[model samples]
Target: MVLDIIFLMLISSTSHVSANSTTVLPAAAAACSNGECQLRDECSTDRDCAAGLYCLSCPLEFRGSRCVRSTISDPFKLLNNSLPFNKYAFLTTHNSFAIRGEPSHTGVPRFTPANQEDTVTQQLNHGVRALMLDTYEFKDGIWLCHSFKGKCHDFTAFEPAMDTLKEIKAFMSANPSEILTLILEDHVEAPYELSRLFRSSGLDKYWFPVSKMPRDGQDWPLVKDMVANNQRLIVFTSDRSKQETERIAYQWNFMVETQCECFLFSCCFHLWIGL
Candidate 1:
């Protein structure tokens, strides 16, 4: 059987009529107030829809697109309960930390774009199991950012990375049966900084040791086992050296992706275990 996999690559927080500006259509404004739109509610943009829903257009189904649930079912709960971790799929959110309406931390207006409208907690609550974060060294600590030159400036900085990590830790603590993954586009240069962040955020408590990672295209450990042992958090870093130095897994070594081009900035893909 061909299992469906979803890899949500964030492009814009909401639908737009132009590449540089976002405008909510009149239909959305007239249909519902922000955060009030529910399933089947008429919407012209994602901002007009409530959390866990997005505006989508279907020419054949109805006259106009209505708010629809953008959620994923827990594969483990619906499918096999004891499958290898690789056998299951996750709803992966790209640039999960670049959230709209996030307050400025540098006392300057944010000049970067937002990729998501929901908070990290909300994403987790909506069943997003994997998060892709762009991390950089900023303001003497690691921060989430979207920069042009791989260096985080005040205008590009979102928030301190610890804030989001702690949110993940809290979610896992409250939901003991869930597993989460973090894929980092790492830019931190300091030694052991990520290690320190993980520890301080209390996420280290659920750390999946790199030693247990498959090395020869082998199936990952059973998801049930990972959850039962409380080793439910899997972290992957872009920097290969960090694998040995920080004891975090290198993303390329463990996961393979097949992406499809959809737009200039947005795309989706399937992630699979790789040799």
Candidate 2:
């Protein structure tokens, strides 16, 4: 499979906190060290936990970081896989491509980031299923920038969107059963060129065709269907011209209008599609 190739091409390059990995408490619970946690009995920080557990502060139902699981449970995993992709809710990030005030782990250097310190890969790994990205044509590349200027910031700088996207591709390659949605605020003069990035990153293989997508008010295909066929990646853009190509899906046509109003340039949503 094409993903198999991508997996190999990027496997050695991808960097993420493995799911099975654990960490220490936020602050010092008591300055506990490996000696105290060696038996998997005590943990001062995430690193103090054993190989399988992470540190979490919980109530009486669950105590200590490594001793027990979190009292909370992830509801999304309990959803029926047979439901259409749109029927389920997803987590999304605003300024998905921008970092808070530091450079991203997988993007170009920048003095100032959009709003978050975490990179796209970090967000995705943390369970954000959708992203709100601003796309603009910079000096030679299509980069992610903040503001209507669509150019590098006065003090901060724009990051090459492709870099973030390639990492996204890497994440998708590794997590096949998951689905991702990209909502792009278009500021680029030309949108068709985005396809080049898709091809270059090898994400085109995972592209969910707009033709196959459901219209507003229409139900979407099941998550199993999308994952089974490897159509787990979906893209939507504010620029309608981009829709001329197979890679970009015009957002309004697919996601119905909602009471949650947004300006033309803003792309982030609390939860945009499905119930």
Candidate 3:
């Protein structure tokens, strides 16, 4: 019985040692080193860190790894103290309306041809400050090839749209004093692929998508380089969550620090206003 007690004690002691070995103490994180640190994932600025964790400098407005930033008092401040809505006009083909048939005796106005330009002009008169173009090829008389009944035709085979864009660009170039903001959607492909298309079209001075936040960090060096190279592409991010907004804001702060143009595209305009 005495020998059994000794064995039990030995087992208990072993168990205690194992438990102690696995126990972790919560304390201040360590300083960052060579882009490595204890709180690396959570580190945005030195202020976000505890005693041991290395505090890296965050871009303007960004506070921490969680990417917290204060809201601007005015959305117009984002557009160089000018209202984006007032400074430019938006033009697009998607919003154009078509008239399918002749007017009937019932007094419904009908026409055979769609007056795309007239519709766009009306929108321009209403104060649209930017243009968003959907560049996907249409198939079978459908602009969206993925849709039903569009599989038989290819839209990219046509050149009229490209020519039209060139004319518009030329016109905008002539009126350089007017602010011209162009928003391009990639239509179901990675942004990098769209970058190639822009390059091929000689449109390097447009906005492109980036995965990095606009701050002076390892992740943003490429974005800085692109800006330095006069790529003329602004970084636009689409964020859906508060956490994501924080992260995007941090990156935006970094971009803002570098004087790069950054914009956010969100579905929840109301929520963004609250923020």
The best-first sequence of candidates by lDDT reads: 1, 2, 3
Model 3 per-residue lDDT tens digits across residues 86-158: 2211222321222122123223332222223232233333332334333343321112111122121232122
**RMSD to true structure for each model, in Å:** 8.7, 11.2, 24.8
Top lDDT: which candidate number? 1
lDDT of 1 by residue, 20-120 (tens): 32324343335685778887778778898898788866553345877878776888789866987776766877788888788999999999877777888
**Residue range with the least summed lDDT across 10 consecutive positions in model 1:** 10-19
Candidate number of the best TM-score:
1
TM-score of each: 0.78, 0.65, 0.31
Candidate 2 off by > 4 Å: 1-76, 104-113, 154-156, 245-247, 256-269
Q: Model 2, range 1-275, lDDT digits (tens) per residue?
A: 00000000001111222222234444324545553443335466767655444454434223554433212222247776787665565556667666655444335555553555466777777667777778777767777777555555534445677888888989998987877878888877764577777788788889889888764345677778888999988888888877876448887656532334444333323323321
lDDT of 1 at 76: 75
